[model samples]
Target: MEILVCVKRVPDNEESEIEVNADGSDIQRDDLVCSTNEWDNYAVEEAIELVDEHGGNVTVVTVGDDESEEVLRRGMAMGANNGLLLMDDAFECSDGKGIATILKAAVEKGNYDLIMTGAQSDTGAGQVGGMLAAMLDYPYASLVNSVEVIDDKKLKVGREIEGGNQEMNEIDLPCVLSIQTGINEPRYVTIRGIRKVSSVEIPIQVASDLDISGDSVGAASARVKKIDYFVPELGAGAEMLEGATEEIVEKLIEMLKAKGGLK
Candidate 1:
């Protein structure tokens, strides 16, 4: 089945520091180096594997400036048939909801059997995947660790849960899945594949092109506001009680119970 894998380019955490912009609002990227959001690599890989097993194509899409093409090319080299870069000045300031809205519109424009995205983006708030699914009116499963073809038109999925629990679900074609990390090991781009898509000019779409509204997105439109950011201070060194094994164990238990560690 045809699949659309959504990806994003953000500041490389390794090379960037979080600093408020001049407006004292969102983080600034003027001095930060960009890279593909790492979690999305798994989404791209999952799409490639799905298309390889079933006879179909994988299309990777990202909303960003022209530089986003770098990450899109990386997806192409990993086995996506083509890529779409949805870029616009408005998209530069998009919040999670706005990004989801754009993605919903883009997916609607394509004839896709399934859509895939990472569980969350490294930058913005982690709400786009579920929000996009809702906007598209498609069934969604998040934190998916495994996916299998249950039938020609159905898929079985396993989602990771807290406390070592796993939730299994089944959904028909034309659904959305937010893939979790450790779902599968993503493949690296080979030199030959990299060369092939390096010069290929992928298509571009803008806000007006999609008839999307800029006023509905970005910090200006955000429902949640960041008051401020400050690192929490660490406390003093741990207290140690010198005693025999049994005494120490009892003391530890008493301390834990007193702190409500064991309820």
Candidate 2:
């Protein structure tokens, strides 16, 4: 199938206390423990499974700095055939479209029949896959939960819509899909597996190699800028519930009755 799955490395939210940086433009990441994006795990798994049954290869790619190579290696450890690293100082602080432009250039460098991305990253923008599809002028789908190969040229895809309804459609090959989590159980990658692929060559592409001019990308070219990144303050009269599930449930019940929400 020649599938290309886009993955990302992000701070493990569960392992750290995330706070807006002093600049307010990003989070404090200096001490953060980073790992592959959770949703992307499902995307990588789905792509590998598809290629496994269809007799083809899966390539995992990401746009990040040198440290980002670990996620690529992790994907390879999960059965992807190859890894791609798109690294460049010019790509720093790029907006959704700017990031998409870089990804579009990388996509052009391959002969992939399908491109997949996580529905959303930690940033929660969820804009890369759709924007990349638009830039490539290819058919696109988002929140895809299921995909079935009908033939070499076609696929039956199921997506989750509002109200939690599932809509199915047939999309042509050479299209893009934003994979939703829970689509599959991502395989566990042992430390040994990662060490095995540590020697595999992963090509790194830069702005010059992709023909992307300096001014057209990076912070200066970014149309959308993050002015602030802070967690919302709790509203008035809000009480926090703490403890085990059973304790929380009892507290909720007491609060609801006291508030006249239940009799």
Highest TM-score: which candidate? Answer: 2
lDDT of 1 by residue, 168-211 (tens): 99998889999888888999899999999988989999888788
Top lDDT model = 2
**What overall lDDT goes with each candidate model?**
0.86, 0.93
Predicted candidate 2 versus true structure: per-residue lDDT over 113-199, tens digit per residue: 999999999989999999999999999999999999999999999999999899999999899999999999999997888788989
Clashing pairs in 1: none
- Go through the candidates in order and give the clash count of each: 0, 0
Worst 10 residues of 2 by lDDT: 225-234
Model 1, runs deviating above 4 Å: 15-31, 235-263
Indicate the residue-level lDDT of 231 in model 1.
Answer: 45
